[model samples]
Target: MSISNGIGNLQGLSNPVTPASATVQTGKEEQIKSSVSLAPGAVKTTPVTDQTVISSTSELLTRALSGSDVRLDKIQPLQAAIAAGTYQVSSSDLADKLITSLLK
Candidate 1:
């Protein structure tokens, strides 16, 4: 098998190099470019508008607390029904549940 040589052998290339002038454009020197709009409807996105914007962290906390407190109040009736022995539980269903618990 023949061994191949790499870019290491092509060293010291470009015998003559001439210095060239560089151009740098400043903000003021930059040209203002405009494109011809052919589309009838172009998407124009306005800045994000929050229907419900929490002004402060405390305000957000108050709003969340209000909703959670209302939901917690609903569990009171279910708790009362179970405590008053009004909640009907079948014997066979109870035995099945116990058997399921024992199997687990």
Candidate 2:
């Protein structure tokens, strides 16, 4: 199965290819919106109701990460250790992990 971003391009769909900006020939009120199927039983047909777009990548990431919580309880101890010059780094372990990740 193929996946599409579905925001605009519809080159290979079984459904009629309609660009998001396609104007309705008969009506001024409705514009033809495209439906993209990422996989079989993946994309469900929802009513063409509203069109909302994220302004930018940063804005999209900000909105996506907005409601997430930071674990200050864990971070505070790490910060304290670093500040007091007690934080230890295992060079061999770090090298091993870095090599393993590169292999993957």
Top lDDT prediction, candidate number: 2
lDDT of 1 at 25: 37
User: Against the hidden reference, what TM-scores do the models get?
Assistant: 0.28, 0.34
Return the TM-score for candidate 2, rounded to 2 decimals.
Answer: 0.34
Candidate 1, 10-103: lDDT as tens digits: 4455422222222233544332211222233456455886696557988888878777445557788878989998988899999999999999
Record all residue pairs in model 1 with backbone atoms less than 3 Å apart, i.e. clashing. Answer: none
Which clashing pairs does model 2 show? Answer: none
- Worst lDDT run of 10 residues, candidate 2, spans 28-37
Per-candidate Cα lDDT values, in order, are 0.59, 0.71
- The Cα RMSD in angstroms, rounded to one decimal, for candidate 1 relative to the true structure is 16.6
TM-score of candidate 1 against the unseen true structure? 0.28
Candidate 2 per-residue lDDT, tens place, 1-104, comes to: 97777766655655654555563455533433333424534665768898887679979888889966888899999999999999998999999999999999
Candidate 1 residue runs with Cα over 4 Å from true position = 1-74
Error of 2 at 30 (Å): 28
